[model samples]
Structures are given as structure tokens and as C-alpha cells.
Target: MESTKTAMEAFEKLEKVGEGTYGKVYRARERATGRIIALKKTKLHEDDEGVPPTTLREISILRMLSRDPHVVNNQIEMPLTKSNRLLDVKQGVNKDGKTVLYLVFEYMETDLKKFIRSFRQTGENIQPNVVKCLMYQLCKGVAFCHAHGVLHRDLKPHNLLMDKKTLILKIADLGLARAFTLPIKKYTHEILTLWYRAPEVLLGATHYSTAVDMWSVGCIFAELVTKTALFAGDSELQQLLHIFRLLGTPNEEIWPGVSKLKDWHEYPQWKPKPISTCVPNLDEDGLNLLSQMLEYEPSKRISAKKAMEHPYFDDLDKTHL
Candidate 1:
């Protein structure tokens, strides 16, 4: 393996971009080429264990996923900082003497979450065409991941990185992602963020599939149009309630075997509301696509590939983007 120390010396650290469950990200520039990049440094605690599971998983999955044009490119095990150079004092090290791991990536200007928030602050609605483009790109990236047998268990505005100039969105933060094709250990439903979690996950369905990600895509689609999260629930129960309120409480009739999940419980009955009521800015075709993505029955949820073929994107300009 290449020493990360050498790789670290190649870039001039600019500023801290973001932090997540696994590590901190920094914007940096390469000294030789003057190319900008995002550097994610993972701390390996000396006392507890080796590299964290999340970091290991992220590096492994990203190596395969990055082969696709739509997924973010990540160079793993590449030497980063110089060996002789002193480490940045701000990024505290573990008591153990082992070196930290640095994952190099192409820098993106901003994320969809911050972009939406910026528009909201300015009281400006995102252009309809721009929304369509962004959603289409998101679907492409998700489709690519699904086709490769990887499931991005977590998909939200914050995880979608966007280049401000090109408006190209690349799916990032694959720490929670895993392969679903092969027979493996049972999965936990405690994966996705509460707001974008699917009903099956909330009901403690351990053997979930791509439907979990599709449900999140639906929530993100709505958010893009409204500039706000569709289901901003504070807790797991409240999250399910928010989903049920809009999509109606699922019954055995609407979703077979739904009542058999581990976390199943009887709750208040609420009729499904029109999606347009929440995302009024969306057109008929857009609303139809959103409905399919948010289908209560996981099997009934729209796949990312099918979503790209929806009539809502009939006139979308694919040439420029």
C-alpha cells in the first residue's frame, strides 16, 4: 500500500468542507498540477480497533462504484501527505501511532442541500427545467449503482454533490452502501435518515432491497421542487406518521405482508393526500413520476432506470448536460 503521508504533501489544504460519521472532508489543491480536490481523512483510533468499519466499507465500495461515470471518482490507498511534513494540528490524531487514511476525490462546489437552502434564503424558486435536470442526473447515478448490484442505503440532498457551474450532481457518501445481490447477513432497518426512510425500513423489515433508496429519491424529488424536505419528522414514529399522513396509512390491502413486520403497530387512519398539495409546483407528469417512486409497496416503487424514461423528462435537454 502507498503511504498516505506522501499524498498529503501533494495538496495545499484550502478549507474544511464538511464532516460526517466516518471522517472530515477538506478542499485542497494539488501542488504539481494545481488541480483542486476533496480530501477525506479517516481517523483510526489506536485503542479501540483498526480502521473503522464505515471507512473500510466506503473505500471498498467506492473503488467499484467509481468505475461508473455517474458515481463520484475516489482514489483509495493513494499516498497523500508527505512523510516528513507535520500534520495539520486541527485534525487531531488517535493516541495510537498508526497513520490516518486519506481518500482523494474531485472537489464539488456545493451540495443539493446547501443549494436548496441558498435558493430558499433568497426567496427564489429553482427553475423548473433545472429541477428536472437535477432529478434526472440523480436517477442516472442511482441507476448506475443499482445496475452494479450496490444499494446506497442512504440517499439525501446532503449526500448529492453538485458542481455549481455544470450543475452535474454526483452521488457521494457511500459509507452506508452495500451489495444486495449476493446472499449475505441480514440487514438492519436502522440505515437511512429518518426523513427519507421507506415505510418497510421504518416497520423493521430487515430484508429490504433497492426500494429503500427509491423511497428516498421520491422525498428528494419533492424537496427539489418545494425547496424543503417532504417529511421532516423529528423521530422514527413521527417520520412514519408524516409519510402515512401524506401517502395514507398502509394496510394489508394496499401493501401485502406490511402488518407482519417486526415494528408493525396500529395507528391513526389517514387518507392519502394529493402529492400536488405538497409539491404544487410540479406538473402532472412530474407528480406521476413522484407517485411511483413513493409507492408504499417496495416492489411497486419505480426503479431509477424506469424513472429516467418517464414523460416528465421528454423534453429535457440531455445534450448539454
Candidate 2:
């Protein structure tokens, strides 16, 4: 216990960066190496059984994925280290007096949401080449996860971290991620953020697959181009409405089994709009790739690996990036 306390004391807490369902995040610097890291302090409930399921799941998935070369080499360049411990005097104390667990990760400068907001405020568009590079990296990371039988249920601009100097995009926040392999278990539709949530998930399909992540990628792609959320709905119903308005309402004919979803309802009928109409600046190839990702039918949605090969990224200088 004294050694754990010493280890925790090795890092100096810098500032609070953000908070989530599990815990608070802070920017901290190591006293020994002066290395910076993001410290995620997860609260442990006194009445709860053990470690939170989300934390266990995240730690396990990341452990398995951290071994993959594709993930370690290019995708979100952070090594997950659990050795460090910290005693939080403020928010870590439980009714039983047990301290919270702190997860240590290499520090990243910003996330995609903040990056997009900066561009929006500057009244400038992200360079098309930069978008291509970022999207390719995102697809690569997602592909690695899916190939490893993991599904990143929560994929959005806010969860995607980036190093401003290198312009490298990393997929972070695996709290909602799960393994989607054989003997599959039912998943909650209420997983991803509203704007990036897949249509099938929105309609309450509990038996979803990796295609859910693709839908989020499509939304992020559109956001990268327009510097705004493609479907910014305030509520779940409005979120569905936003999707239906743009892609047309799905039916038994178009998306088989969609009507059978638990939350399926008789939504207003609408015809699909041309992708080019909404993303006017997106070229033909970009539109084609985006359409495949945004397909209402989860089965029809393009896989992250397939998306990485789309013509939209044909000209990307992969070697340089």
C-alpha cells in the first residue's frame, strides 16, 4: 500500500481535461521522466461488487489490441499502462473509504471535435488531403479492432484523439467497446452518441455488428468535410427523424428485419436525398464511399477494411503520412 502510494505520488496532477461515466481525466506529468500522461481516475462504488464492468472490458480489449502491429504502429499511438496508482483525496473516497483506480495513458493534445470546432471558428475548411489521411487512419484503426473481434460501440469526434503536430488520429475511449464474436450476446442500442449512432441501433436493434462503427465513421467523414455534425438531434426520436429525413425511412422491403426491431415505429415517409446534395463539396468517389458506410442495412454497410481501400483515398500519400 505504501509502494502504491509512492507510485501514485510520482506523477504530478496538472489539470482536469474531461470527465465521463466512469471517472475524471487529468493531464499529469511524471516526476522521474517529466513525461506527460492522461490520468483517468475511475470511482469504485462501495456497494458495487468489484471493478466496474466497463473498466474490465476496456482493459481486456485494449490488452488484446495493444499487441496488434496495425494498432500499435499507426492507430492511436498510446501505450496503456496500469502499473501507476494514485490516492484521490477529493472524489476518490467512497462511503467505505476505498480509493479509486487511476488508468495511465500517453497524453494526447486534442480530439477531433475540438479540431473541427477550431476549423469552424476560423472560417476555414480542413484541407481535403488532411481529411483523407485522417479518415484512412481512422478506418485502419477500426479495421484492426473489428479484425480482433472487438467492436468500438462508441465512435465519435470527441472520442478520437489526435496529435496536432503529427496530425495522427487515434481511437480512444473503449469503455463501451465489446467483443462481438461467436455465442454473441445482445448489445444495447443505446451505445454510441446520438449524431453518430447507426440507423439500426437507433431503431433499437440489439443484435448489431461491426457495421455500427462504420455508420459512425461515415458521420465523422461528413463532419470532417462540413465542420458540423451531419445529424445533430436533441433526442432519440429526433435523431431517428434526422436520419430518416436524409436517408429515407427504412422498411421491411429496404432493410429486412428493421421493422422487427424492438423500438421500430411508423416514422414519417421520406425519400432519400443525394449525398452530393448534403455534402456538396465531396467528390464522386468520396460520396460513393460515404454512401456505402451510411447504408441503412447493417449488412450492406462497408467494413472498415473495405473502406480503407475506397477510391477516395487512392491518391493518399500513405508512405509520407
Candidate 3:
């Protein structure tokens, strides 16, 4: 690791671009090289642990997965200023003497959320070719992670970074990703955004697999086509109802063992409607792939590797991607 005191002098924060539960993100520039980068500053307390285990897990995972172009690259350095911690995320003290961790990475211009909002604001649909390309890239990146035995339990538009110019998308924010090899462990159902969350997770199934991410991919696919969230829910129950109303209430017949999940309950039933009614603009092949991703039974849901081969993406030129 390089001397972070020198790392501190090498770059300057340009502006705060975003903020999340863990830290603030800045659009920064390396003074010496004139290279722009994104700086994620993770705050720590002197009274607490040296570094959060979640952050360390993310570092380990990113090191393994960043070789894929679709996964965001993480660059490492030593602690800045007066510090005793050994970390790749350069450490320093804030103005108030509070410890902070800075993670440096190549900057992306925008994220999927803002990109979709741009099209929505302009009353224009994201081009079909562009949608396919984005989704294909998403599947490819996701396949890479799953193939490596890691589960990115959370996948949403905000976590997907993109370059406004090339529309190249990269998966980020791996703090929520769990890399434990399975026989799936009982994780908390509390993970993932409600709308993108899998039906099994919403039903209180703790032992989830990679299918949860596929559900989010399906939601993102629809949002890209319609320029609106497929299912936007404010609460846990509301989220389930939104999904149930559209996909129709799930039962043992379609999603066996669903009724036995921890959060299972009696609810009003609705027959499954043709999936096309919602995304009327999506073509047959797109609908087919979306349906497979949104499958109620986790086991029946399509894998990312399988999804990348779907006919919906057959027209894409893979050489560049």
C-alpha cells in the first residue's frame, strides 16, 4: 500500500455526488495524474471497531470480481494522516477528528435510476436496443458473481452504475452481497428493496438463493421498458400485494411450500393475468425472459447465465460487451 498521506495529497474532492447508509461519495480528481475518480468515504468512530466487517467483505469480493468489466473496479491504498489501521480504503481523520475511510474507483457519470428518470422525464422510452444491451450486461455481470459462488442479495437501479456516454453499466455497492457457499443459509428476509424482492423473501423465507436477484433484474427490465417502476410499494405487505395483484396470488400449486413460509398468511386471491398487460411495449421474447426472471418459485427462476442466452438478447453484438 502507498503512503495515504501521499494518497491524500495526490487527489482532491471535487463535489459530493451521492450518499448512502455507510458514507458519502464524491466526484474527485487526482491532482498529479488529472484522472477523475469516485471517492466513497466511510465514517468510523474511535470508540468502535477498526473497520466494519461488511466493508472488509466487500473489499475481498470486489478484489475477486472486479476483473469483469461489468463489475465496478476497486483500487486500494494505505491509511492517510495519522492512522494505525491496515486497510485498502485509505483512512484519515475528518475535520472533527472522526475516522473516515476513503475508497477510490474510476468514476461513472450516472446510475440506472437517474438514467431511467431522464427518459421518463422527457416522455421517451429507452431505446429497445439499449434496453437489451443494458439487461444483457446486467445478466453477464450477475452471472459472473453467481459463477464465483457469491450472491449479490441486493440488485436495484440505484446500485447499478452507468456511463452516460457509452451506457456501459457496472454493478456496485456490494456491501449487501453475501459470499457464503450454499446449501443456502437462513439470511434475513429484511434484505433487498421491497418491489424488486422475490416472492419467497416477501413471504418470510429466510433461506433464499440467487433467485432473489433475478426478481430484481425482472423489475429493472420492466422499468427500463416502461420508464416506471414495475412494482413500487411503501411497506412489506403492500409490496407483496402489488406483486400478488399483478402475477396473481401464489399458492402451493404454482409455488409449492409458499403457504408454509414464515410470513405466509391468508389473502385475497387473484388469477394470473397475461404479463403483457403491464408492459404492453415489450416484445414476445422480452416478455418471455422477464417472466422467467420473475418466476414465483425460486428454483424455477432463470439463472443469470441462462438469461444471457435468452432470445431477447440474441440480436446484441457480444464482441464489444
- TM for candidate 2 is 0.90
Which segments of model 3 are wrong by more than 4 Å? 1-4, 68-88
How would you encode candidate 1's per-residue C-alpha lDDT over 1-321 as one tens digit per residue? 345556666778999998977778889997889978788877776665656676667676677765433212243211111001112222234346665777778777889999999999999999999999989888877887888788888899888888676677778877788877655447987657988898888988888888889999999999999999999999889998998999899999999999999999998999999999999999999999999999999999999989989999999986544
In model 2, where is the ten-residue run with the lowest total lDDT? Answer: 81-90
lDDT for each residue of candidate 3 in 118-210, tens digit (9 for 90 to 100): 988899999999999889888887887888888888888988888776667778877788896768888986767777888888888888888
- Model 3 scores a TM of 0.91
Query: Which model, 1 or 3, shows the larger lDDT?
Result: 3
Write the candidate numbers in order of decreasing TM-score: 3, 2, 1
lDDT score of residue 54 within candidate 3:
77
Model 2 lDDT, full chain set = 0.80
Q: Name the candidate that leads on lDDT.
A: 3
What TM-score would every model get versus the actual structure? Answer: 0.88, 0.90, 0.91
Clashing pairs in model 2? 76-170
Candidate 1 Cα deviation (angstroms), residue 7: 2.3
Stretches off by above 4 angstroms in model 1 are 47-54, 69-96, 183-185
Q: Alpha-carbon error at 175 in model 2, in Å? A: 0.9
